[model samples]
Target chain A: MAAIPRLTSRLRIAVTAPATVWLRGAAQSHTWNRLSGGGDRPRHLDLATLARLRLIPLVGFVVAALAVPVTASATTIYAASSLSKVVPSIAPGNTYSFAGSDTLAFQIENGAPADVFLSAAPLYAERLHSKGLCSTPVVFALNTLTFVTPASNPAGITRVQQLDRPGGYRLAVGGKHVPLGIYTRTLLGKLGLGRALTKNTVSSYQKASDVTSVIALGSADAGVVYTTDWYANTTKLLAIPVPASAQPLIRYEACVVMRPGSDTTAANAVIARLSSLAGRQALFNAHFGLPPKT
Target chain B: MTFRTGLFLGGLVVTLVLTFLFLLTPIAALLLQVPPRDLPGLLRDTAVSSALIVSLKTNLIANVLFLSIGTPAAYLIALGRFRGRPVLLTLIELPLVLPPAVAGIALLTAFGAFGLFGSTLAGLGIVLPFTQAAVVVAVTFVAAPFYLRAAISAFAALDRTQLDAARDLGASEAMVFRRIALPLAADALRAGWAMAFARGIGEFGATLLFAGSVARLTETLPLAVYAQLDVNLDSAVAVGLLLLAISGGVLLVAKLPPLWSSAAPSSTAGGW
Candidate 1:
């Protein structure tokens, strides 16, 4: 019975206490400042006055953005997200924007500022070429799709056939139009397990890296990703080589983007390095397959 | 008009118009790309229809969960004069500042198959990540705080004297809450829920990271837009417009008065 009054008092103070505490803290700080011989000055902004003042920075940002192209020197390379790990190592000095190849192609078509376009699949590069957004696609490297499971093998998957076994396991793949996604579906279709595999797919990521992450995190029982992706995450993933009969010939294509104000000379040089002996060796070391001889 | 005064007014109007245009241009672009005449055909695509169903179902479940669980928690924080109350509020509001990507990874580390309680959850025959349930959890983590913060403010703003009088009349805490606090805070609570629902329906990064985007399973509207981007630009634009319309409708409906309340003449103002 006596607890009710205590509770009521506490409730009454609870809502208003923070304001008083803040005021008391401010007062104590002011006293300390005076004792230390510091000059008095209010430390808070007058928000009403700031309403107009804020536009100065906004205008400055607009001006700076407009002025950037005049002095921009670094070559901007738009590469597929799959090349994110290897591209910088191959060529260390350029600005790179890594995303889905299809997305990069679409952006180049829609006028994104890119000097070079490197894609995991020839399809996106061909699309850009047809649109006159880039040079003719060049097959610089090749990759093959492989099955990867979490190191723990949570679903106890040992072979590809179990992917469609009874009491199905979760599988993560790339999105429908993603190069890896297209290749995975093609591989499954060739193996005559397409229907069953589609049923087992739980997530389709836009980035191949995301598919690897999901598998590595044990969020999915298994996933299909590039041979290079599997090698990059070797510690977290156990790879199951795709059967040769169904393995798709995954090609890495590159071309110089034809946007206005782009550094085409530098972009072409970047492409040259990718197809050069050192670049092919670097890709080989990273487990990417070399393109067939012309 | 004085030159300086006229200049200030003109500058203010220009700023307002610029801000409005900045906000509206993207919406206008979406409308132009995917006009109303093409919506029905876009909806016929199984991926778009499945994504819409998944979004509505998951967000609905998430909002209901928020109302049931969040309201009581807010009341406790507002009224409980406990130690660490400020800390508690900060923890509740932390998700508001956390990038949705960070929230996704946090969820993964805490609840994923190999997370902190991985074996414990596995023992219980539960796998949270990569499912519709995971979608619900992702949205709840990021969106619940919006409702909780609003609810705390509303409950704290209640008339303490009326509450005290009710207690003096021998009303139990539950009775006082149901009879007084709940009714008074109803409007703000609805608005908070609507905001949360809007945020949940459009949740992308976290859901993509935590739940995985499988059409008809875990893909919400935003994920659908991303997925469609690579497939068909027009389809992606159509889905984005649908999401915008749904959010707009939620805000509109939440702002309007309840039909029953509006239908009845207010006794407080009646002299007829």
Candidate 2:
């Protein structure tokens, strides 16, 4: 303990020396300007002014050096909200897992240190691919949007059209930007119930899980969530299917993000696993749709 | 310093340099990752705006509610003689120690739609989960203890003679509380408020599990930040910077002399 302070003082001196030299250069420039009659006298000068100015650059360098390790070691992956149920099941050995397509897409575009990207909807993935975030992504699986209600089924919603019925029964759907909610909206449009459903929609969530929780908890009379989400939440919910004509195909996609010069082996492995039979089985077990050929 | 001391000092300097870089890199990256031209457009996003508004509104309401109910309870606990005071204090502080996720689960188990009161609430046509109200409740549960603990300490620090002096001067119980006790405890109240606000603003797990991250409804800034990261990493950084800016502003406000002065010892000790 006694030696600690002495050591710290020496360390500070060593670290601050370069800054002090830079400051001296700045001071000399000021003096040269004054002697040459370049302009008015320097605004202010103090004994350690050079050290203080140099300190800023030294701190900046130190901060930049420290950040390199964290950026290199971690890979951020953006996934859809529905993946909240699936990712955790597979993420124990993997490097990254984040939910919500919009959130993920936003982060990746903003230059977060992300290596792999998955989205609930093909549109966002395609958008990123078009913008050169990655090569063209492959459709990995499918998702089905369904209505869920509490076990008691208080709203008695038997068909897709009933959701638009003239009643005060609350409905929860994902936000307009969320894939599941977009699909729900598309389905409603196809069924000619869009206007009515929009009027009665009480709340919109960022993730399907939020919608499912509302229905499962009986907060809303009904809510739209993915088929897999309903399966995962069996204890508190019952899934209700929309009519065939109104249902839209929900495709999941994945892409290997192309960093400037980094290796793509890890991303390729993820893609291969997703395409393989074992991966399909895992998806099936999680109640996600198997790719058509599988 | 001896050569050994000098060598140790060198090592310490290197470690600190590395540590400073580790902490500031992400924040620096957040600032640098965005194109200056795109920032305004990103800030205009409806989802981002709504989440920010919801976060601020909910945190404010939760802080007020926590302060109002927690202050008197803390005072009673701190000043009154009770056999189970320690146990009650511990219970009040229990939520503070639990992980936010666990707190969320506990809230769900007790108040979820299928929880103990779920059926009862349902029968009464009341819903608690996945609403703005749930967000407020979750924040309050996690943040109340900070205020309560601080308030208790502030109340305990008061000199009893001051209260006696107020009473002897013919001030009623309510007057004494208003003029003397409360003034003495102002510092604790402000500290408690700052703590509660900070905790409430950053609350995530409980809000996610209990309130549900409904866009434009229950989604807070952190949820917004998380959601952006899911789809667009750049957007996430932008949103994160926005959150960081707000947090920094709040911290500055909390530390300002006007706010800090209220908690200063002399002014809070029932000074004339």
Candidate number of the best DockQ:
1
DockQ of each: 0.37, 0.15
Q: Name the regions of candidate 2 deviating beyond 4 angstroms.
A: A1-98, A105-116, A260-263, A292-294, B1-61, B98-105, B122-125, B130-132, B161-176, B201-205, B212-272
Tens digits of per-residue lDDT for model 2, A1-294:
344334445545666566566445544464434533546544443424535544444555567877876545444555676776565455435666566776677677767666778888888888889999877888888877777778788778777667666645667777666787789888778878877554563566676767777677666778778888888888888777777777888999988777675347776776777777777788888888877763
Q: RMSD for each model, in Å, please? A: 10.2, 10.0
Per-prediction backbone clash count:
0, 29
Taking chain A by itself, what TM-score does each prediction score?
A: 0.78, 0.73
TM-score of chain B of each: 0.91, 0.84
Over A1-294, each residue of candidate 1 has an lDDT whose tens digit, in order, gives 344334434433543244334333433454434533546565343222332233333454566778876666789999988888888899888999998888888888989999999999999999889988889989999998888899989888888887766448888988767899999989988887777555575688989988998899899999899989888888999987668989988999999999788898999999989988889889899899998655
Candidate 1 structure quality by residue, lDDT tens digits, B17-79: 989999999889889997799988987888888888999999889988999999999998998
Tens digit per residue, CA lDDT, model 2, B122-228: 79986787678899999999988888888988888889887887788788877766777777787567767787777788788888777766667788887787666
